[model samples]
Target chain A: MRGGTAVSIAYQTLRLSDLPGLRAAIRSGDYVKHTAGLGAGHLQTNLAILPEAYALDFMRYCQRNPKPCPLVGVSDTGDPMMRTLGRDIDIRTDVPAYNIYLDGKLADSVTDITDIWRDDMVAFALGCSFTFERALEEAGVPQWHIDHDTTVPMFRSNIETVPAGPFGGKMVVSMRMIAPERIDEVREISRRFPLAHGAPVHIGDPEGLGIADLSRPDWGDPAEIEPGKTPVFWACGVTPQVAIERAGVPLCITHKPGHMLVTDISETAEVPVLNPKHH
Target chain B: MRGGTAVSIAYQTLRLSDLPGLRAAIRSGDYVKHTAGLGAGHLQTNLAILPEAYALDFMRYCQRNPKPCPLVGVSDTGDPMMRTLGRDIDIRTDVPAYNIYLDGKLADSVTDITDIWRDDMVAFALGCSFTFERALEEAGVPQWHIDHDTTVPMFRSNIETVPAGPFGGKMVVSMRMIAPERIDEVREISRRFPLAHGAPVHIGDPEGLGIADLSRPDWGDPAEIEPGKTPVFWACGVTPQVAIERAGVPLCITHKPGHMLVTDISETAEVPVLNPKHH
Candidate 1:
């Protein structure tokens, strides 16, 4: 809200404390726009819902490749209620947008999936890069995409994700232009949020990850690398989406890019440290 | 060898560097005993093998309850090899002892499982308490069970585990007597090994976890608490065993209580810090 150019769609000037109200609006179909600054300071997530047949493999896929798919919450089979993520959070209609895929191809994008929700389906919410992006911004790091009103540039890389079942493909990475001097500071800050794709996978050369052309990204608009700025890459949530496509599951549902599931968990909630002495 | 009374069975003096040789000796049936001090500085694991029918649920079960079941390695379905754990490791023959369970009942204890190895079976190696115990010992913490040449006392606690499919039961914990003054130091040291059950789940009162008597443990011999000592409880690997029992799977195989699967991974190996700066 402070730095980025606002989108054309009208959104209420909401504060971090107004998350429940915002979510209610999203559920009522009153707000179908991308959720960026609406629920500021709260954790927003990427959504992936699959059938029971594919649930185990996809869960394993996430476990093996945590950098790309840091699982924040998983719903029980056939249960639309994601109690672990938030109160009254129904997977069938919580998100603003959902992309339904059939046989590895996108069939339709819908605002509500209550009609198509299946008893054999399971929903998984993954930590989105937005969590760390917010952290970086709060720490005074500049984000070029937010400065201009554009999506962050993302590209496919040569790094192959650890395969699980039918899910295996080259990792997808989101690129950000940062001054070389701030690399270490950014790394340290980002490393603390393991659920939000912890740290940058590649800091310097895009070519090192087999990325030939920076201007031509696989997804999102390309951002120019200003002089003295280095292109830093982080494992993207899209990596799992691509893997899901490759797996060719009969039916899959995901959040439309930029449309996320906002949760009650605060972005600054202390990552659960295992301490027996206190318990 | 230094603190505990030695077992009567003669074991050739083996050093940290003698892991491969010791594992080979164990595989050849030359050694069949507790693996606490053997292969020092290396990771030792508790094994759990289940049929594919229950594999997904069990994996999910472990994921939900990480403290009791810190998964270190999971083999592909029908595969006898654990490629990630160690070189030339065969799940069928590597371990010195295996407990075969039939429908929640102990069926038999065997030296080798090659005869019962099934194409539908999946092998999982969970991080054992031994890894952090080694860390504690290295940090000058005294383990009374090890000092007395007895197994650490284990008890079933009243705390229920987060259920996954058919796997849900009260958590199992192993008790250790520590000086009240050294509790903080021990907690700090053990917390570093997340893969090794990390820190204690409970610190002082045994009855807080519904444990009535410290001297009357459900399993393993009990150690007398010395003056100025407090009981510390860690989530035990035996947790999964109890859950599996409650699950009542048709066929499940696990490692014999103390006999573990020794891996090539060093106990002090940096627990895979996800640093994208290098890659």
Candidate 2:
């Protein structure tokens, strides 16, 4: 939004107060659309709901691979309320869109998942990259997705995540082109959001992560690499979803890509530990 | 151990490999005493086993006050195997000694807790101070405890820990007297072991943490401060036990102080961030 680029899509204008009402609108079977620019300045989350049996392993998986699965909040067993992430956030009815996966296959896409909600289900809210992406823009980094009116390019990488039970798969990463001189600035800014995918994993070549070409990504649109810029890769939140799919669980529910669950917590709750004191 | 003065205890007489054999001896009801200096270069942990209902609150407490209660490993409900801490750790009988607490009272002391283990209980292993103490000795910061054949002096400080649920109390700290010149070296060495109370919370004076007299410690034997030495305090692991005692839980079990669970993980495993490049 800071860059002087021509606007293509009708950008949804929203205020800080619009969040709870927008969530309410989504809860009552209204406003079932992509939540890209809606509810500005509030933290949005990637959702993963599974049975209590898989909860421990999934939690360990997230702990082992924090960059891709930075956990924001965990729900108590058989409870839908996520107290840490938001106030009165019902996981069953909060998100604008939900995707149901059955035995590693997409079963259906729906607006509300309350009818199929079970007692043993537990929801995990993971921090998404959008929070840090906004931080990057504020710090004066040029993002191609904002300028081109397309989703950020994400690719399936060959970097395997640490295994915990059935949850083990190659990490997926999203790429953004940044000016070479701004590389340190970008790293310093993004590393603050450990809840989001903190810092760039790879700096230069896409082939380092086993990608054959930059034009063809596993998800999202192709990114334009500008002159005097380098491609910076960040561990994407999609990696956990991909791992969940690979686990072949009976039923797994997640938010539809780009249609995130808006939370009441601020994006800047805890100050970043740059050269972390470690205590 | 590498200092000028002669000591009652012979330093470096123990080897790292002796830990497993010692633990085996303890499991078979043989080495039923304090575990100090038994395992040379390995990590030892303080134990806290509680019911499933209280696990979440305690976890939040540890998350809030990581300096005092740095969680090394956590066990699943009804599971005794602490897979993350070591290769073969059965939480019920690993430690040489155990103290059973019932509703804020000391119910009994035992060698093994397997007979009293319940199906709904969880075990947590918190990092102990021994790791940093070893690092301090290696960095040439002499401690009075090893020289005098006694435990490090501990005190209940007025510094209150961040509260979570029912777990809220003033932090307890362990004091070690070091030469004023070596204080920076002590901080540099101890900061590496974040799990083990990482850097000194207060250095140079006991009165800063609200202790009126240095010679009168709340716990452990007080030692004489040599000329030009200052009293340094590190957040003690005993603070969590104090909180648990005050919480008045129906049943709780903890390691008798100095009788910790010796882990196979090396002292260097205390590093929080293992860069993927190194992995």
Candidate 3:
């Protein structure tokens, strides 16, 4: 909404507070831009849709490694509606846009996946760092990426996720520059949002997590590190995308990067790891 | 070890602090008694092992309904070793006794399940009430059944669990008589250990949970209600067993009632819903 090009369809001007209106817009192919700054207080999820065959192991991968893939909700096998996440939330057309992954590689990007929706597929909703970033802003500790107007820088770390089926790989982490004095406050507030990757897995040293450079992140745009601040990392939702890509399932679908599915759930609602800590 | 005869065999005087010795005693059929006070501060677990065919649904069932099925650990799809739970913990011989369920009914009870263990089976260790009951005792709220020297009273509640695949049913609750003034403290402490069926689902009236009479529990022995004390119910680990029984999986294995698999995990180590809130 802030920087991306918004291609509005046949609809009135959409307000940020209107959840149903926003979803309806997304469903109707009205707003296909990134879901940043929209539905400000509500939960925004990183989406993953896969065949039922891979769901069990994939879920095991999630349960074993929660910080990266804090599963918020899982749709019933072959079911399009995610009754658990919110009201009338259809997984197929609810997101702003979809990324079609064929054998774990990006094949096509589309507005809606209604044409490719299959009976054997299951959808997973994971907690996004945006929830905690909002919490941070409310708490008066603004994040680096938001201030710089860039995507949260992500990297593949030396930390290996607990393997389950074919979906195990190095954990992908998002970097944030935290002032030395405010690190504890950030950790305490973040601890309250485990669904939002909880507290940082690694703080201070990037080499401890085996990343060679801070400016060259594996994914997302790299940001500057202020003189007194240290780089902090949280397990990223993109970790699962990395794993999914490595797993190479015949058919997998996800929200195009930055494009997310916003839900009716409030940010303070615990997303309920109270899991999106093992859902 | 106290009331139920601990048939101590060839092993020389086993100390309660020794985990491997205890497991060895159980594995060798030396100590085949109910594991109530055996491990003391160490973690005890309720178990369910199903072929990989049903593992995903069962795990999802655990994820959806965490209180009743607080998943402490899950083994790899075909692995007998619960490396995630503890060091060198083998599911086949660790539990004191195993209850084999076939087509939703009790088929056999055995001291060892090595012969029936399948290559495709997955074992799930759930936090037993003993973990929280130990916590409660430390908090100075002695439970009625423990004080009275009887099994915890259990009943089927009208509250249905969140269904996942073939594993949905009414929640089974275990009741403990708490003094009216201490309910809040009990609830807080219970919340801290979400792994051990955190917090009570119902309090005071038995009818609220569709429990007909406190004197007649559906499972386990009924303990007398202390006058002026309130009846509080916690979601029981037995809930999953009920679901498993109803689901009628071709091959299912669980710990015999009262007999549990004791692990090396400490009671205070969080089990770690920080899960047993979502995991």
What TM-score do all the candidates reach, one by one?
0.87, 0.67, 0.89
- How does candidate 1 score on lDDT? 0.82
lDDT of 2 by residue, B228-274 (tens): 88888899999999999999989999999988998777777522223
Model 1 per-residue lDDT tens digits across residues B1-279: 532234333653532237877777777776667787777677899999999889878877776677788777777788898766676788888887999999998999998899999999989899998888877888888888887878899999987877788998988999999988899998878776767887788899888999999999999988887778999999899999999999999999999999999887788654322223343
* Candidate 1's TM-score on the B chain: 0.93
The residue-by-residue lDDT of candidate 2 on A1-279, one tens digit each, is 522122123323422237777877778865676676656587888999898778767876776677888776677667887765666789989998999999978899999898888998878888899899999888878799977768899999888887777998999999999988999999889876767888888899888889999889899989886778899999999999999999998888999998898987678754111111222
**Please, what is the whole-model Cα lDDT of each candidate in the order they appear?**
0.82, 0.79, 0.81
The local lDDT score (0 to 100) that residue A256 gets in candidate 1 is: 95
In candidate 2, which residue pairs get closer than 3 Å at backbone N, Cα or C atoms, i.e. clash? none
Task: Sort every candidate by lDDT, greatest first.
Answer: 1, 3, 2
- Per-residue accuracy of model 1 over A160-190 as CA lDDT, tens digit each: 7877789999999999999988999998888
After TM-score superposition, what is the CA distance of residue B170 in candidate 2 from its true location, in Å? 10
- Return the TM-scores of chain A for each candidate in numbered order: 0.93, 0.91, 0.93
Worst 10-residue lDDT window, candidate 3 chain B: B270-279
* Count of backbone collisions in candidate 3: 5
Off by over 4 Å in 3: A1-12, A266-279, B1-12, B37-41, B268-279
TM-score of candidate 3 versus the correct structure, residues matched by position: 0.89
Model 3: lDDT of residue A59: 84
